[model samples]
Target: MTILGSHFVDFDTARILVADDDPILREFAAVHLATPTLEVEVAEDGVFALERLQQGGIDIALIDLDMPRMDGFELIERIRWDDQLKHLPIVVVTGREDMVAVDKAFAMGATSFVVKPLNWRLLSHQLAYVLRNAQAESSVRSRLHDLQRVSDLKDRVLRLSRQKLTGPLNDILDSAQTIEHLSTIPEISASLRRIAEASVALTRVHADMGEAERLTPAP
Candidate 1:
């Protein structure tokens, strides 16, 4: 693909939305990009496109810069602004190869762009690549979010352990140690030593929990 792309898209099932003011272009895209595993949906304008997108199930979108009701740039912005639609892969298909328009589309969160007079033979490959890229990005984002959540939970647990357990445990260990030293009776000293030992073990466990985050993760 001439523009940005990613992993091969799934051939088992994929849905593409083409939003353009030109019915001919829309029809052309639908005809060429479709496969047994991939289906294409068309919208004559950005407004209609956005509506279909809002209903969900689209895996990628090919958008035209010029459209009534809502332009491609605005549509891109709107899609990115909507949390549910933000990650949807968007490829801008423009009539001109103007760099400014291309940059603007990207700034508005388009996944990629294609200049006019597209090569029909390569269009499907381009769409597949774009979709794969989007999915990979989404996967990375989800993993990072999950890791953050685990980090936050670990912090909360450590804070609780320090506040509610560690201080009291230290006190118990100190008291046991003092009692063990003060007592002359062997049995009493032995029992006090065990209490101190148990307290020490628990405190060590808490410390280990605090350090667990730095430990190497399982593959």
Candidate 2:
């Protein structure tokens, strides 16, 4: 989540927004983004998209150039001008292939463009690429905002696990010391059993810590 690396993967669970006047087209795009890995949201038109953007929570917008009420270009312009929405990544998904339209879209702050009849594979690839770039950009901004939260999450896991380990580890150490002191007892069988149990307990704590470190993000 921190850095949306440069790679484009097909089965990645990404949140995508689609805005199209035609329900069929919108549905088509939405369905394509809905692989087992993706989460898709739809907006019927530019107006609806603006509302959704205001509400927030969208990772990327897949917009149609031709629409009713407010067109995609106008929507892009408004999005770029709005301070709150300025950084939102936009990808034009439309039938219009006119150079003028493409130029206008870029001018209005679109990050990528895809001419439509809807190629699912290509669209998926493009979306993944756009999302990755968006993530990189977001990561930069997140560093300024609350990246410390990621580190906090890692620290919290370590703290809780350490707390849980403390009691068990102390018990293991005490048992080991007791076993060492009781070497004279009946063949020393009880001492050996205690020492073996303590060793197992200590091994588990360290093993769990190693697994936790591999799973948790570092800052």
Query: Which candidate leads the pack in TM-score?
Result: 1
Q: Write the per-residue lDDT of candidate 2 for residues 1-219, one digit (tens) a residue.
A: 223662334645667889888988777776666766677899888899999888877778888889888899999998998888899889996555576888888987999998867777678777888888888898888896676776787677777877787777767767766776777775585666667677777768767886777787555
Give per-residue CA lDDT, model 1, range 180-217, as digits (tens): 99999999999999999999999988788767744635
Task: Write down the TM-score of every candidate.
Answer: 0.78, 0.59
TM-score of 1: 0.78
List the global CA lDDT of all models: 0.85, 0.79
Candidate with top lDDT is 1
Superposed Cα deviation of residue 56, candidate 1 (Å): 1.6
**Candidate 1, superposed: residue stretches over 4 Å from native:** 1-12, 167-171, 174-184, 197-219
Q: What shift in Å separates residue 91 of candidate 2 from its native position after superposition?
A: 0.5
Task: Enumerate residue pairs that collide in model 1.
Answer: none
Model 2 weakest lDDT span, ten residues long = 1-10
